[model samples]
Target: MSMGKKILIIGPSWVGDMVMAQSLFILLKQQDPDNQIDVLAPAWSRPLLARMPQVRQAVDMPVGHGSLMWSARRQIGRALKAEGYDQAILLPNSFKSALIPLFAGIPVRTGWKGEFRYGLVNDIRLLDEARYPLMVQRFDALAYPAGAPLPEKLPVPDLHAEAARVPQLRAQFGLDGTQKILALCPGAEFGPAKRWPERHYAAVAAHKLAQGWQVWLLGSEKDRAVAENIIAALPQAQRQRCHNLAGVTKLEDAIDLLSVCDAVVSNDSGLMHISAALNRPLVVVYGSTSPGFTPPLNEQVAILSIPVDCGPCFQRECPLGHMKCLNDLLPEQVISALEKLVPGHEQAVL
Candidate 1:
């Protein structure tokens, strides 16, 4: 095992991508328990990184996505020079993502061949599409020598949630401990193409509510309206039982609260990956995107997707205007998956 190495991991921009990156982190840790791994990502990701025990520190990426702030990259990169990172692994294949490590003058910089980044990344890899089908597979493969066979089972992301924070968050959100919690992550930051119909989520919420469960909607502030709509669709009695925690809880708060959920039903979004990492009983509804690439890394998940000729187009919004893939999928399918998964999880409820 490579011992006492210091590494810098340039994390991905999206939450799901970042979560999936944990597999590589776990792999690196397994290689050398004493290795110190630090992540460079957006400031918002600090909370998420804190839950990852494998990460030693979270360095906030000052620049936003899309725009390449060379000065900003140079500043952060030069600052990291003193840390003396032995190896810098760039997760995102973008040309800009390679700058910081290069500016830092790290000796061993590695990443997939992207945007013809030659000198920016020294140990560049040539990706054989068939060999590394999943994004997680691609990420984990970087931890080994060029032609090394990956382990039979790559480590899955298991986040560490503070046990004591669960109750406080429950109380903060007015969550009833008596009822089984069903968390609905109805928003997909990628776009509407990946989101399951909000009405469909409401249907699952209603069903679980009928079974004496308290439904909680979780997502960013952008998802507030959808959460409210889901609640509005519920009957008056059930509406009172459901809570729209979306737009209210901070990312860390969401992490702690989600850890205690009896079941989670989410779109193919970051929360889906987070739920899987938390090892929650999850039923993820897929639309434009298929699980073939970035499926939730958990055995406790039930992935629901319907194949349509037009999709998985992987577009931000559907070009055909008809969301038959997700529309046809229906809530009954997700609820049924939940019914099966929840009972098994308790043995370890929806």
Candidate 2:
């Protein structure tokens, strides 16, 4: 087996997808301890790649999100070609996403077959969605030989930022040192389709606080109002233990705070993936999206999704004008998941 091979991976634009792909990085590292894995991704994903030690370098694909993808691909391909990558794996399923490596003239271009980039990609593997139902399974297929055994189900990548960075951030945020941290991520990028009811989140947060857990709500500014609503529902005494960290921490800081949490309760969002990557015990709520496609990778993680007849639609918005999947999830169900994660919290065993 050759060592020091340069592999350039075209990463997924979404944060959660990136987290799911981390297992591929782990496999590549295991094959050759000295392997050089570089990533070409959108500017926002750079912070995430920074935390992964397997990546030798991350080249930002300098382009806006909308159309105009070709122009950006050419630019990224030119930059990657200069670095002399031996092989390239395209993670995102778009013809435009493969353009960079084609233009760069990388020797082996590998990816799934959906993109119809015949000339651009050399080693296109035919993907049978039925055989490989999960997103991680599809991602792993890209790296292996035609029918090689899948890499041992490795734990999701656990890459921490500098040790000093997390502590400084904890102090900056005024997080309680003595209390067990319970990270709450109440927002979903897939609109309101996958979001659990705010009242259930509040109830669960209040319940955890009564047991001496500190609730740190996590989300972007778009989620601040929802976080605020949950905070308001908590009792005044328990509310003091609930710190709204929304709109404050950057993506990197969010990872740091998540690292410290004893467990995280989150909607099916990028934050949930991040917590799973950190190996933190996670309770993920599901609604519109099916766990079959994008479940958390850790065995320690618990996923709760009410299987409604209209579910697995994968729609951004509820199509039936009702979101019963999330609205109907009880606070007690969430509390039960958390109790199993929390040490010394005894509950009736199933």
Candidate 3:
């Protein structure tokens, strides 16, 4: 039993990756209740870290992702030395990600052997994709000794939302709590390749609205245009019932608001992971990416992806000049998946 061992985690920069990292935090707490877990991530992830009970605190990483700010890394690492973190876990497989922990002089630095991070991480493990197929599994493996068998039942990421704030957020957004809410996440930060067609999203929104459900489009400021396009495609009556909340609410507000949603239809983006963590019924549409690697870590999720010969290409955009993978995926498929995921919704209006 490692008692009172403080651990520091170099978290991933992407939103979905940060959410999935909670599984590792849960495993650390399970291993020893006295373990103090702190995350070093981007400034934006503070709100996310607040939702995870296992995290003691979130230290903002001063350097931007992929930036080789040697002096900044050294300063941050030296500053954390007094806290005396027993171990530092590196979530990103980048050489730069290991620099801070190494400079901090943490005794045990653990991570996968990525990008010549040989001496940077003292307790490095070679990743076996088959053994740890899911991203959650890879994160959890860092908590245990090398070659140790993982627990049969791994803990899933469950973010805690403030029920009290739900109503306040709804009021702030002028949302009606009387109707069943269907949250639509139509943007993917990775790029357009991962995003489902906006017309498809409008179709789902229209169908749900006709069935007496309110639609809420959720995303960051970058997604506002896409949200508007979805609304523009809908009839005025249906658009009246659809609320475009993208770029309006803070991430924390979105988190609390999403908790109140009956179901969520999203691309394989960060909000999809957030919705899953909130335990909402989720239908994730995958285009360029495949769910075989990083599926939403929730039982209530229905993954929709078309098998295209050019697909699972994992590119930022379509290489063949056509996004047939997402374009070919009909809205009816997503609606049917939603009906199966959440009962009582009317059949998709073609």
Candidate 4:
């Protein structure tokens, strides 16, 4: 038996991208069972990497996103020289993302040609978006030779949750995990354009609560207000069953807790990807963005979007005053999608 190749991957900064990167890791491991994979990512992604079984270890990228701290990157890169990584795969297209591996003197650095990353990455492949339509496809392609045919059955990211901590997390959050859980992720880090209306979320929550299910609102502190608004929209009795855990739980806690959800209704956000990776029955709503590019990788997912003329603009906020793309997308549509993904739920309230 021979020790396989050791690879260092410069991971993406966003949570969703990091989740998708697991596909590439799975592909590498599938190709070579002995392959050792280490991820270089932001500190926030450490918990995410921990959930990925393919990752041997996660090295935190000292430099923040968009920061070109040459000396800092050099220091970190030089420090990793002792690891003797056989190959470095850069997931981000930024020129800065390629610098560390180059500085570390890692042989066979691989990535797409972006931002004039000519000499920085020796094994650069010009990306053909038409050929590789999905982001996961592009990432998985790097695991093989340039222009090589990707596996017909690409592995979807399946994140492992710390089930032992489920009890502790439930106790900490005053949740018993006795009732059916329906998680609603209404916040989009991308911006307001991607967020489904709060009232719409409330409608879903109200319906689930009527069916004797608990609603868990998930997001960062930035989404606390939105979560609160959703709860406020619910009737007083329904609000009692709703948990506003948006700002309350850490990323890891959210991951473990989300594993127990019977179903999830979310915007096209990081948590949406997380829920899908957990293999939860997911209903994802898209507004400013379209599913053509980064649809949920899970099989049990329903993506809902209303097409408008001004649409899929991929903007932070709607350019026109009316956000008909999202506002026009009724809660009933999402509830219908959810019922399709997870049957036996009560009919939605119009």
Candidate 5:
């Protein structure tokens, strides 16, 4: 643990996966404070990676999204060779994900066996899913030496990256600095299957605005239409106070803004993870995905999921046609959940 090892990490391509991967980065720092950790990741995740302080640099893999093989492994191998990395941690399960380090001849490469990559991965570990209490715990175990016990759980993510533009963003957006701000991330990257009803979010925002808090809509370009729908549902007075930041600002800008919020309401998405990482008070709505595996870890966070027969369908879209799991969750219920954190937060303004 004391050795200053040069470690190269092949990062997860998805934003949420990238954020979740921060725990591993944090553990590496805790285990070896001086180790130089660099990440080989897809370009899209670069925005989020910039915020993590643990990573020295995020090497972009110039390849398409699908099962892209040639560029990723080749680029990563050349980079690892040039950087003289001694070990690598592959976060993704694909054989292509492991190809880089193995090709680079890094002495130790670790990952779960997938795509029959036995020889490609030297230190492959069997993920006894039952042994670890949580998904994060299971992922964290991969970073430790073989047979090492799980350490006491910690909440903070290792991404030492910061939101450099938050302060300016606050001024530009005309956000009331002193008043409590509530971030509403209504869209889920996974798909409509995981997203709570738009009405539910609108109601939550309306409830908070009535309580004297300012509502800030958070999401990407794809989520802007949803944000607008929610904004449109609010009363003119409430709408005036609500800000639609979707697609306007960068990813770090949203995180910086999220860090400043008194609380956040989101679906099971990357922003939820960011809110948890920042230790912001949060109410995360879960639908197709169960919270049992990767629920919010921060003390200030809470999960709002209604269990149903088709609870963990785990599909991109609802197979049953009736998205009862999400639609059935009333706005009042989410408002009630938020009220606990921001007291009188619902009744104050109205």
Candidate 6:
């Protein structure tokens, strides 16, 4: 609403972070119902933004991740200058991410201090990691005055799926809308350290498949091989019910399809956050990463992790060459978590 402050948000590059950013958007709206929020992020993230009703629009940031394309950012900034944004909240702490708002000459630029973004972000806050242990807390903190205490209950990310298109997508993917479905997100784009073993995933898939639940593997194109491996481990009958939607469905399509899933078991991946936002029952297996930082924010979710001394290493690939954390977090833990999220013993048509 032009009646309130026209705020421009420099959104995060990763899908999970972008989804979590919705909490900040919600807080901004709660603070001022008429606050207009527009996000500048990667083109791929537009689909995620579309589902967050709080966002007025999605502004494409043409620069690729890690690229300091000053000319490109300046061009986009010059174009947005006409919009007259009152404030800019940056989810990313990078110095380059603060450039556009500065270029646009937005009066008040807000973000945490990083890469020595001293003058570029006029309203920067020095982060206190001890105070804000959670990543979501850090994002939410930017909405308030620096050093202000956050609300006791921070809003979780909630994405509105295109429910009307569910049937069409189901038909497109040969999914029966009434069938009991279990969705699995087996890939962690961060790297192998965050991923649970494929065989462990297969073990869980077998548990659900035996209980007459169909399994749908969801991830980006990079995850196709792992999805195939999960499917391969199942018997012919169970394999028929296990569908590899990885690398096939678009991100939005995955969001819509996940809406119909009875439950979801996933690594700490983007799709895991999506499923949580959709309010689907979820069990997230943690490895190199820990839930203490970015736990899935949903009532119907379970956070699973077997803490190894080596982890939460937070590394992309395990430096020790042994991912004891993920490898040891057995399938039974996930299945047990699934049981708590959803009482899944009910009979389903095979």
Per-candidate local distance difference test? 0.91, 0.84, 0.92, 0.93, 0.81, 0.91
* Model 4 quality (TM-score): 0.98
Q: Which residue pairs show backbone clashes in model 6?
A: none
- Model 6, 68-127: lDDT tens digits are 989989999999999999999988989899999999999999999989799999998999
Given candidate 4, what's the lDDT at residue 296? 93
Per the 3 Å backbone cut-off, how many clashing residue pairs does candidate 6 have? Answer: 0
lDDT of 1 by residue, 202-285 (tens): 999888888788888999999999999999998887788899998999999999999999899999999999999999999988
Off by over 4 Å in 1: 1-3, 344-350
Q: For candidate 3, lDDT tens digit of each residue in 71-154?
A: 999999999999898999999999999999988899999999999899999999999999999888999999999989999999
Candidate that would win on lDDT: 4
Tell me how many clashing residue pairs each candidate has: 2, 0, 0, 0, 8, 0
- Writing each residue's lDDT as its tens digit, candidate 4 over 72-155 gives 999999999999999999999999999999989999999999898999999999999999999999999999999999888999
RMSD of each: 2.5, 3.0, 1.9, 1.7, 2.1, 1.5
Ranking by TM-score: 4, 6, 3, 1, 2, 5
Candidate that scores best on TM-score = 4
Task: Return the lDDT, model 5, position 191.
Answer: 92
Off by over 4 Å in 3: 345-350
* TM-score of candidate 2 relative to the true fold: 0.94
Give one digit per residue, the lDDT tens place, for model 2 in 250-299: 99889888888888999999999998888898999898888888888777
Could you tell me every candidate's TM-score relative to the true structure?
A: 0.96, 0.94, 0.97, 0.98, 0.93, 0.97
Q: Please tell me which model should have the higher lDDT, number 3 or number 4.
A: 4
What local lDDT does model 1 show for residue 25?
Answer: 96
The best-first sequence of candidates by lDDT reads 4, 3, 6, 1, 2, 5
lDDT of 3 at 106: 96
